[model samples]
Target: MPRNRPLAAVLTTVVLATLTAAVTTAVTTAPVAAGTAGPKTVIANLFEWNWPSVGAECGASLGPRGYGYVQVSPPQEHVRGQEWWVAYQPVSYRIESRKGTRAQFQSMVIACHAAGVKVIVDAVVNHMANTDKSGPGWAGSAWTHYDYPGTYQVQDFHHCGRNGNDDIVNYNDRYEVQNCELANLADLDTGAAYVRDRLAGYLNDLLSLGVDGFRMDASKHMPAADIAALRSRLSRPVYIVQEVIYGAGEPIGPLEYTGNGDVHEFRYGKDLARVFRDERLAYLNNFGEGWGYIPSNVANVFVDNHDTQRDVPGTLTYRDNGIYALANAFMLAWPYGSPTVMSSYEFTDRNQGPPSDSAGRTNNSTCYSGGWRCEHRWPVIANMVGFRNAVAGTGVVNWYDNGWQHIAFGRGSAGYISINDEDFAVTGRSYRTNMPAGRYCDVIHGEKSGSGCTGPVVTVDSGGWFRADIAAHDAVAIHAGARIS
Candidate 1:
């Protein structure tokens, strides 16, 4: 499922339209597990981008654009492979993975921190490399099955021998899922105190480096009790977003993990895709618990991720630009789960590594290439980051829908957005924009370019209504950040 396509243009736009293209964005710090009480900003999963690219852009690009954090690839030693998932199978906590070396990683963190972009790394604590032969890892750490040179021994691993070889078979049984190896990856005995100490040491090593949070990978595979215990061992309250996919008949649910931190709402992307694609806009009035995606505070939402982009159906990817952009607008505008923007490369093969050199290091010539696709750079998506931040604590008031495809809503009195999902244009009609009598920049399509608007200019009267025409598959979003009129 790797998409091999030329990278599109670097997405560009400004909310106020005052800054140049390479402007330094003054990033606003936000909390994780976003809700109405969520982070003031959002996260960008820089899938497989190297430390140099990450460090370089922190000040020049991301911070200026108002991103709260960047969830980077696993920055630990692992099996050397061109496939993406190999990073998840760690060899050591050496800070020398495919992304960068130890010094480069530290420098990147310092740079991002200086830019006000918190770094949340993907922490893989569930297992080790799924290898048959013993060899040195990317960081030159040697290890055999459950036996590293100076670390874990054979006793450190679990012996949940399902299918007679420790490979997980019965996912319905919670024990096999947690204790047994996943896809031949060696399962760690997380219940052991010694193992917990070792895990904490690695995590503390990262914490010492000023990492603000962690995205716990395959969190469901580890028992909730163990995760809580692991959190207890942490030195501080680092933001945690557990990766737990709640699918059919899964016994260990996200509710069990919420006591510690947020859980990624895997269903959000799939659900929204279906809702908007079928023109089921009116049914979303009760979008949070009414649609069963509730307990808003602990939910981390996204349109798609590195995993779902290739495999899961009904996810809005880069391929479907119009509908995908609409879904992203709704995600940012909606006040439910805390949203994380997905930034990935263009690929037809799902497992293809990022654009890199022969040694598998990132080729960071352009911010994106035929190999890299930075979705967060898109004007609509990037500006929405500012919009969400602008309307952070506000409630979704002035909800409007045609009882069919078209819809509009106000985030308190701070921001307003309208979507015309119908095939035909809605012309010569007045819509309740819920704004004061003034001129505002429609940031969905463009930005303010000085005293002028690059997108469209909407004139609102005293009654909070505007006579406007909206096209098919397009939306209009305006917030306090870009309001000139």
Candidate 2:
């Protein structure tokens, strides 16, 4: 769900103002899971992309680039508005919104599956539309604040009689955080069996239509036990990643929800940004557990998501340009957590939705032409997907950093990468890795073409040493999968 303005201010100031250390001393990294149906664990968050655009991207880019999953914004019918947050304010579970009609959404799923990519929906189950407004939803379903004709009723919500408006004001109190409204949006009584069944039914509907998984939105507002009950109601097991923002000293943290499934490691993007902008890139050598984040296996990490791109202060967004690409390159090269590459559209206003018609139907995305900033398609980010897949199950080795903005590392003998964030070029440096001797494409700058590369190529000698000059804020990555000879 997109962050609400009023609530965003509170969350930015109170909950996420401080970057705290990891809450638990968990395992460093979980062993990579055995092969599954999808290509890999890399997810492309195509936020606000229409269903047709999503389907086309599957065949045109996602499949070719080795993306395992694509997470779409909430597909349910939403309030009538051009603001992006309206998608988060559900009026009904109908699969009709500015994104597309239900048929179009189903087609997108089929196309993605055909392309060997799984679909993960951003499921908004914690609340309904803001109680203040009432009208026909996007799908023509008449809905009031707490009442949907064929879905939920007033009793399905939690009228937490705290703060005058019932909106969450105290992050320290677990009960208030879970039961109170978030930005005055009607909070669902998730603990209630009836409400849980309704939410599960909506998710099951998506599964029936071939959705492979779900990104549980606003999971922090629901107790872990309640979420488990909702999961139990699922028709079958589907991949689940819950959004449990880790607030410092908060009673309920992201770790508590790991039992349910993978949790969004919010700290990753923030800490990563801090290192890229203010701290040293060498510090990323001890990025994950050393930085006190959640266990790598059950953590879902991203450089910047839709919300953080606008609301969070410390993270990097598309505006960072080449430096942002370098950050993503490092993320893909580093075996930290399951990485999600965020593909966003240009937005001058926080509430501005994707490019849409007068009636609010989203237009087809014209990458790099219209508002779409297809970051996932960027050379450094897209090509690195293959690098990540090639280095799967391999641990970091031959790590090196210049004690500041330059760092290099290898994943066993499968892949190697060196990122230089210094203001000037670091020339004539020979970086040693465990990769086999061969002519490999420098995936960061150019992709592998037939028998060669389109950009600068790096040759590793028999002794596993590669000599190259890295430019300021640039990177060079070579993987076994892209070896030319």
Give one digit per residue, the lDDT tens place, for model 1 in 1-485: 12122211211121213112211232232212112222455898888888988887776657767788888989989887778887888888899987888888889999999877899999999888887434688878987778876778889999885698998888789988999998888889999999999999999999998889999999999999898999999999999999998867778788888998999988888878778765467777878767776488899999999888886466888666666767888898998888888878777787787877898776662544556657777667777787898788888887888877788898877789888766556788776755677887887766665676776888778898877787655678887666776
Let me know the TM-score candidate 2 reaches against the reference structure.
Answer: 0.92
Off by over 4 Å in 2: 1-39
Q: lDDT values of the candidates?
A: 0.78, 0.85
Looking at model 1, residue 45 earns an lDDT score of 85
Q: What is the TM-score of each candidate against the true structure?
A: 0.90, 0.92
279: Cα error in model 2, Å = 1.2
Clashes of each: 18, 1
